[model samples]
Target: MLARTLGALLCAGLLVGAAQARDYRYSDAHLHYVDFFQETEGMPALLEAMDKAGIEQSMISGIPVAKKWHEDEPKRPRYYAGDDADAYWYSATDSYVAAAVEKLPPEQRKRFHPFLSGINPVDKNAVAHIERMLELHPGLWQGIGEVFTRHDDLTALTSGDTPRANNEAMTRIYHLAAERDLPVLLHSNITSKRERNPLYLAEIEEPLRNHPHTRFIWAHAGSSMEIHRHQEKMDFLLPTLTRLLEDYPNLYVDLSWSVLQPYLLDDKGTPRKAWLALVERFPERFMLGSDVVGRFSSLGEQFQGFAPFLDALPEDIAHKVARDNFLAVLPKPR
Candidate 1:
């Protein structure tokens, strides 16, 4: 009897392992190829992480701003938020991404979709900079952002005028994205940490309304790690997204890990029904991302964490959210 009980437990453990194994592939919809310090683990590390994570493809871009190593600081800060040092727009970041991907063999190179993001979103000349990048590497850039606008603490730390999604500079950038057939992944927060309502909603909404032709992937569905840290939840996010989806056809959402907890999944990590319904209503508009900046160790866990939520979704919709949606948003050949 004891032997039979042990055998039953072994079979149950095997079944659990099989259940936990991921069967679907993933296309990381948002990833920073370089960190605020303008560094990465290199392509070998990234490819290895992706291979382990089951990420077949990725949308790779550089952080537009570089954190300054303030002179007064005794120790160099490891991350952007480590100190009050100002970060400035660094155009060389795009080149870093290009260099890394270009060095890869053709097969490996094809796995990455590089986006140009090394521009100050508040600078009107930013669009011109993007144009130059496209000309420099004819068929290289696949999309436009992870453009930092209205980001949490980064807004305060970034040098120069604050960037808004509806600003003239970003407006011009949006037009360029539409013209070039490149989807723009914008990181415009919906609200500040203190406020509950979508206070900054208009910033993104204006662009969505005005630039109907440009595909805009609202990174983290307008939520940020900083904001999530401060507030329990943005109670208004779901309805706001539903309304936005109903109104704008070109809008897409990146389900990065920041959005997974307390919104899509509850405290116990169970998928929330309202959020599931929202995805079900607009299956083609959602995609998953690791949102890992310059580090790859957490890539597998970042994606695998979504398994509970993805499993709750319908099979077809789950597949689209996991991989197909991101590919669908990529720029088409001319």
Candidate 2:
């Protein structure tokens, strides 16, 4: 009878401990304040959602490019790339993000770390535009990108311009980012959605090798929504990530919602042993993100989705991935 009572108490304690783990607050390393389709609920709503979701901090940026409408389509796309022909650089989006952040109370504003996303990655004048924006904002912008290069489907649609991670234009931007002490969150998909091979790996590798000083947060760990929808699993993801993390000290992985399934969690929604081991090995190098575009209603849900993965991590490492890692990477205040 005494043993049974003791076992019950132990079970209760374990449950309480699990609950505490799930309550871990997060610093969302990747999220968009605005998107091409103008689907956002705006700043006030986002703050409310962040508060509700226990997101203490976030890296906010506007989509640097806009998806063009395809007139031939029988039905308009709810999303930018649904049936859109191409994506084009639109600098005004950055102003919208800046304006929203500026309106927040100083306390609330501090939670938002804004990144400059207005410059076209392939444009010859990309560096000039970045300099101009930095001068204009005067410490308002904290980092650069969500810069799209080698994006699935979108890359093919990117009319006339072919943006590459190692392009001269991007190299110039990397140099400037190093000088300014800003991290660059680049979205260079490692491969096309249909192809399992890391075809575009060179595009990102060159930049990592060339600009060792510039911190590069590889968005979705080089995965995309299309990849998630089409492929049950990326056989190459774990090995590729292991190599990149081992190779590039400056490279960080953004394990956003897109790569959650098959990569981080198995079919049963439990954390994969390999992924947990990877995080354990390089806790500081991995960060979580909702990758929510202009929507606050789902913010809490998006954050909660990582609870299982977080619970499985060592306490200190979980805390770092949830919050500290991102804060550690942010540019020091001027």
Candidate 3:
């Protein structure tokens, strides 16, 4: 009798453990294959991480700029903002992404959607780089960007003319994206620190108006970690996004780490009703992303953190945001 009871308890524990495991599927809409230093943990490690995290598909790209290791510094910096060292546009980063994906087995290759992101957006000649990459890679690249425009301190730290979403260079890029039927992931922050309003609204709005044919995944829905760290919350963000989604059919939002705190989930990690309503109103327009750079260990946690928000959403919408929405935005394969 004692042995039978112990066996039953052991089986119950196993059942509970299996039930608690992460079974929710995910398609990571925003992941960097390399860090700011232009380094990666290799493809094998990445694949392992993805398998562990239950990421069936991922949108992978390289960081547009490489942080410079200043000669004066005694030790190497772990991140871009580690010291006063400047970062510069490194087009070769794209090649790294291309090479990494190409070497994978056919089954593994299909799981990754590569995006071109190493060109400096401020340069008018940037489009040439895009053209060259497309020609070189053929159908390997499915999208463009995580394009750095008006990023907070990174803009100040990068060495180049500040990129604007509506700038002439980006205008040309937008036209090309439309021609290629490629969706563009744009990281044009809605506001900088110290300003309370959506100060840079026109920058992104102009392109959305002009390039209706091209799909634009607005990274973080125009928020960033820096902006959140400083401002805590943007009171205007939810309403602004609502208006934009209502206005622009081509626009989509990447709900990565930046928007998770204070917006989607409150301080207590509960889903906000206002955000839930906004997502329910435009269920097709929002997607999930890990936004993990070069490392994938935290992929599960980054995505699972949204469980509360996803649970609050309708089951169909939750699945869409977690996986299908991102796949919908990618250009149809040739």
Candidate 4:
């Protein structure tokens, strides 16, 4: 009789657990990471921050084109036939030869397991970066993203307007993500085109047509600028934000900076209708993000920046937005 009673209680507990995972995971699907040379260091410290904020894991992303490295491709230096064998391998020869070339100045590349980039030609060694990260700490990375597309640089690369370069880079990253079977997080902006960016319409709708299963997420919903600065544009993004939920099944939005979305309304002395619309229209598409990069003031800092947004969320809907929904898109844990 005692054994039967304990077994019954255990079953009850398991049922409730499933309910929690389904309804209240509270995962932050978007985040940025900075290495030693960036604003700050200490990569492993994020584990504690996530634990305290009730955030489970975040999608970590790096810069594809970095300021530390050359934004433009390097011109190959003419080599003389009689030059010494050692000078022939100078890593400084160009951005393509990168750190691998023996005798050359080291660039801003972080030596994570000794990753040096000045000699690593991004185009040729694009696959190598992914390989290095995987090999260095086999399963440490959760997702691949925060990769950005610059309109100016890409236009110069492609020769045509926005579509040419942006599409090519998007296709490149999309193919790589699909090859590795990881969902990508894009810093989708409305400023791609020269005259009329159409901020949301052209960028989001067009890309999905080519790569159907690419698992591309749009950070900030349809937000164009940063929360602190673009306090005005939240109202502008409303119509497009609504359209995203209806059209893009794979697309998701984060509420990381969106507490400011409501605050924006209050500042303008406008009705709170748009805020309610966001909560009601796409509860599943939202997730929390702190957007902290370096050694922030508080420990488990997700709670610090994320508290306002989380508090504004409806209780049951908050549970889904904060956690359970993101697990649907996150890369499977190794």
Candidate 5:
């Protein structure tokens, strides 16, 4: 009778422990402080949402370029590339992010890490522009990008020259990133949503192969919100990510909201075994992101959505994906 009672108590204690662990605080690996359409809720609102969501820190950047209003529609896009005007480099967007960060008290400011995102990645002058921003900001910026290279509709909308990950301009930026020990958060879509083929694989692959020293966080593991909206399933995502993780030590995937569907969880909302195995095999290579743009209310739901997957993981690995892994990749404070 005593043995039975003791066993019951131990089981109860273990369950409680697991429940507590599920509420892990996060260091959001991907987020945007401003949007192309000027739709941000501003800093105080963002901080409140973060506090509610238990996000201890976040990687924040401005949209590097602004989406123009397509003349046929001549209205602001309800979503990314909704009407599809050309995208052009807008440096002031980065300044908005910088000024927002500057407003916080030093103690509060430490919780936010800002990245430079305003440079036109295709322009040869981009290298000089980035260098100028770095010199202007001193130690204020922590990393570079959320750089959009192969976005679904947005890539089609970009005017003049489209940016490619392996372009000579990006090559120079990669060299600078290596020199400064800054990680680059690149958003190059792996494939188009309709085709679901790894069509632009080489764009990101070349940079990974060439710039092995520069830490590259592949946003959404190369998936996008636009893709998620159009396609209910992502068939090729797992194998492609597995190959990349195997091939490149410098590559880390941003498993944000778009990846949660079909990749992380199945139709019934159960964690997929293959993905679990991949996370287990390369536990340090994956990180979580809310991918929230210009707003903050959904932040809690975004982090909470990963609970099922995290619960399936070993406690340590769950904690790492939830928070620690992101902190690990951050540029060490100078």
Candidate 6:
């Protein structure tokens, strides 16, 4: 009787291990590790959430701009499109814009800078911290990612009076990324005919026109504008997804925070089909992004929002979106 009981337990353990092995690579391409969440909660909190969700890794992007989120319209970052495409919006405040100007030597300051909303002062301490984080917790970034621009920053820089400031800023960040070989996951939404979003499109289109080596994963299926929209989100998103994937190969899309996300589903809502269909079209060309906004006010809601979305996905596709696809892009598993 004792031997039989032990044998039964052993079999159950083996089955559980096998089931876990059968699971696909679970990754989340877009995550916010920044001011609101980072200072208080930090990356460990995010990792805990991942463990529960069975997320093996995540392309965690910290906010590029600290306080400078594109808080306004016309001056909003050009990298964002849709209704404000024609509108002149700034992603951050005017005073905040001057900070990046400080990064350049006096002589070099003549050329306009690029960034959607604002810039982060290169903190020797923070870079040291980033380095420490890597050294102390080697493989901490098995799937961590570039935080890219906060939404507000993208607005201001892209809406600049100058032509290529936003592109130039991206190039600067891209240069840094190329140096570290970290595939930073920036955010962009393409709906507007003009503004920083279109400017962002031009920034990459012109440079990568022939190179074909440049690759970027568009977060949120290029619908950052839909975050606030209730009924009209699909109206704004579907067409954009089709247009973007058709154009950029070095480009991929992540169906982050889509209207079809599971939690968003309730009684009358059924955006899942459209979301799945979009993923079906570009199964290989997409990843997952969960740009859960983390401000003091919204922190509670932002906490662990992506877990449910992960649970909601079919195992196979969810595995790809969550982990495997991102690994294909990383230079080394940090």
Off-target runs (Cα >4 Å) in candidate 3 are 1-22
Instruction: Estimate the TM-score for candidate 3.
Output: 0.93
Candidate 2's C-alpha runs over 4 A off are 1-22, 70-76
Query: TM-score for each prediction?
Result: 0.95, 0.93, 0.93, 0.60, 0.91, 0.54
lDDT of 4 by residue, 209-319 (tens): 566776766655544333335344444466666675677776676655644445324655453556656766777776665555445334355444444444455777767
Using TM-score as the measure, the top candidate is: 1
* Per-candidate alpha-carbon RMSD to the true structure: 2.2, 2.1, 3.6, 13.3, 3.0, 11.8
lDDT tens digits by residue: candidate 1, 286-319:
9999889999999999998999999999888999
Q: Which ten residues in a row have the lowest lDDT in candidate 5?
A: 75-84
How high is the lDDT of residue 280 in model 5?
95
Clashes of 3: 0
How would you encode candidate 3's per-residue C-alpha lDDT over 235-256 as one tens digit per residue? 9999999999999999999999
Flag the better candidate by TM-score, 1 or 6: 1
Writing each residue's lDDT as its tens digit, candidate 6 over 175-216 gives 444555555454544434333323345433453343345456
In angstroms, give how far residue 319 of model 2 lies from its true place: 0.5
**lDDT score of residue 308 within candidate 1:** 95
- CA lDDT, every prediction? 0.93, 0.87, 0.93, 0.48, 0.87, 0.45
Residue-pair clashes per prediction, in order, are 0, 1, 0, 14, 0, 38
Question: Model 2 — TM-score against the truth?
Answer: 0.93
Cα lDDT tens digits for candidate 5, 1-334: 9999999999999999877765688999999997777569999899999999999999999888787777687566866566646777887777888888988899999998899888888887887878888888788888899888888777777776777898999999999999999999999988787876888899999999999999999998988777877776668878888898899999998999988987898888899999999999999989999888898899999999999999999989999999999889988866
Better of 3 and 4 by lDDT: 3
